[model samples]
Target: MRPLIGVTTYREPARWSVWDQGAALVPESYVEAVERAGATAVLLPPQADAGRLVGVLDGLLLAGGADLDPARYGADPHPRTGAPQGARDTWEFDLLAAALGAGVPVLGVCRGMQLLNVALGGDLVQHLPDGSHQDPPARFVKTEVRTVGGSRIAAILGEDTQVNCYHHQAVARLGDGLRATARSADGVVEAVETDGPGFVVGVQWHPETDLSDLRLFEALVSAGKKG
Candidate 1:
């Protein structure tokens, strides 16, 4: 059977209408990437029943969205935390904790990475100012990251990677049990993984933004298939 990778969803609504009207919802392109990778994509909504999710999924993916609740990692919210979706933030965080506890293969992208870090007892840098990042923050520019060769990530991609980054928050103090597997020239934590097994990895870049970035998804699918 194909691996069922559960992709977490965002909880942003266009407007506060009647409760029965429902909110406009959309899944990100990463969902399609999972499909193209030969894995079944399942949208794990913020309101999903966790008791029902564990047995149904072989892997978990935490996608990018808005800022995380600083309270999650024991810090005050940054000025940019903006209109925080406390409910969605809380749900995904709990979902991630459950995934880790269940030893599910997980790939955290962008804010997903940040969430994974927090869930593992790590902290975030709230904001990245230019000239401060060991390299330029680059904001939305395409950039290169140096992976620790022979690490799981480098072994999977098999070369240096060029990715598009659109995040301001980053892994500040890494969460317990996670290790930095890749980094940008300016010292930004670009990639991370668990110290043990289960193929848990997180990248600060947006692989879903480009269809050609299939190698990562393929690797995850291949790992999930092994389970």
Candidate 2:
């Protein structure tokens, strides 16, 4: 059987045709990336049963979304910080905790990366100065990230790679048991990985948006197969 990869999604107000309502949504790019990497994609809506959900999945993929509420990391909101989606934040955090406890292979993208940092007791920079990590009007800015030697990111994307980024916040402190594995030219944390096995990794950029490499998702699937 193809490894089942559960991807966290956004629960937000959306519009479809004439109908406007709240829904669980994730960009199709994520699903395509997972499928391209030879895994079955499953969308996981925000809920309270993350522990239960993680038990059956072979891997977890935390898709990008809104900024986390700063309170999660013991800081007040920054004026430029995007509004938080409390339900999504709570659900994804629970999922990450459960997945980590279960030793599942996990990948976090963009906001998902920030969430991982905060969940592990690390704080964020809130808003990057002078739009270093993002361009104005929420556009994805292309930037190059240098990976650490012998790190997982380096192993996958080589030493230097161009990525698509669209965030104003970044990991400001190293999370417990995690280390920075990549950085942009401006010195923002671009990627992080846990010290042990099972492919626990996070990237500040959107690999799905890049579409040039499926190695990251492929690594997640390979790890999922080992379980």
In TM-score terms, which candidate is top? 2
In terms of lDDT, the poorest run of 10 residues in model 1 is 130-139
Q: Residue 198 in model 2: shift from native, Å?
A: 2.3
Local accuracy by lDDT, each model? 0.81, 0.91
Off by over 4 Å in 1: 15-28, 130-139
Worst 10 residues of 2 by lDDT: 129-138
Candidate 2 residue-wise lDDT at 148: 99
- TM-score, model 2 to reference: 0.97
lDDT tens per residue, model 2, 123-220: 99988876677787768889999999999989998999999998888999978888999999989999999986668999999999855689899999
RMSD of each: 3.6, 1.1
* Each prediction's number of clashing residue pairs: 3, 0
- List where candidate 2 sits over 4 angstroms from the true fold: none
Cα-lDDT of candidate 2: 0.91
